[model samples]
Target: MENCELLEKCVFFNDKMGNMPSTASVIKMRYCREDSSGCARYLVCKALGRENVPADLFPNQEDRARQLIASAR
Candidate 1:
């Protein structure tokens, strides 16, 4: 399988998502969604080219988004 740099750097990327590494289930990384209660990829997709990943964009990763925003500057 191809490596997904996005999932590699994403805070929501959990090794246990599918009982193994990040790609245990999905054949492709893009099809993987964070199982967290927040980012809600069902409602909104991940954002890009920002100081942070954007809380509103990755709602399932709100706390990580906040940290990313603060650490950016």
Candidate 2:
């Protein structure tokens, strides 16, 4: 699958995951590179906007992402 369009600007990698290269790479492979639809940050960004996606939000936090989307609606 194609990489996520928001990969370059994703705070998860640029900031949160900056200190953990190995872990970040693994997550990137699973979410940013392989598939982004399941990424919580991506979900919020798509449903609302990049601004609405919390800086602390991680790719795997799908449940929280759903709640955020719901609250916004």
Candidate 3:
């Protein structure tokens, strides 16, 4: 995932749960700062030597995606 995508998936990256009720619309940031200073993903990315994850990292991407589907959950 790119920096944008990874940042969006952060557990703390709540976008007001969609929008403000009064407006019924989502107000999004026009641009991303693209800094990893305040997120756990920061350490992971630092260790990986990239601003973006490369189809890896459980918190960024689903861990299930790393393996074949299991017969039982």
Find the candidate with the highest lDDT and give its number.
Answer: 2
lDDT of each: 0.40, 0.91, 0.35
* Candidates' RMSD to native: 8.8, 1.1, 10.8
Candidate 3 segments exceeding 4 Å error: 1-5, 15-34, 37-41, 44-73
Where does candidate 1 clash, by residue pair?
38-60, 39-59, 39-60, 39-61
Per-candidate total of colliding backbone pairs: 4, 0, 0
What lDDT does model 3 reach?
0.35
By lDDT, the better pick of 1 and 2 is 2
User: What tens digits encode model 1's per-residue C-alpha lDDT throughout 1-73?
Assistant: 3343355544344433445554445422443343332333322223434233433343334566555545655
Q: Is candidate 1 or candidate 3 better by lDDT?
A: 1
Among these predicted structures, which one has the highest TM-score?
2
lDDT ranking from best candidate downward = 2, 1, 3
What TM-score does candidate 2 reach?
Answer: 0.90
**All candidates' TM-scores?**
0.26, 0.90, 0.23
Ranking by TM-score: 2, 1, 3
- The residue-by-residue lDDT of candidate 3 on 1-73, one tens digit each, is 1244545554324443344543322112211234333333444454443444333333323333222122121
RMSD of 3: 10.8
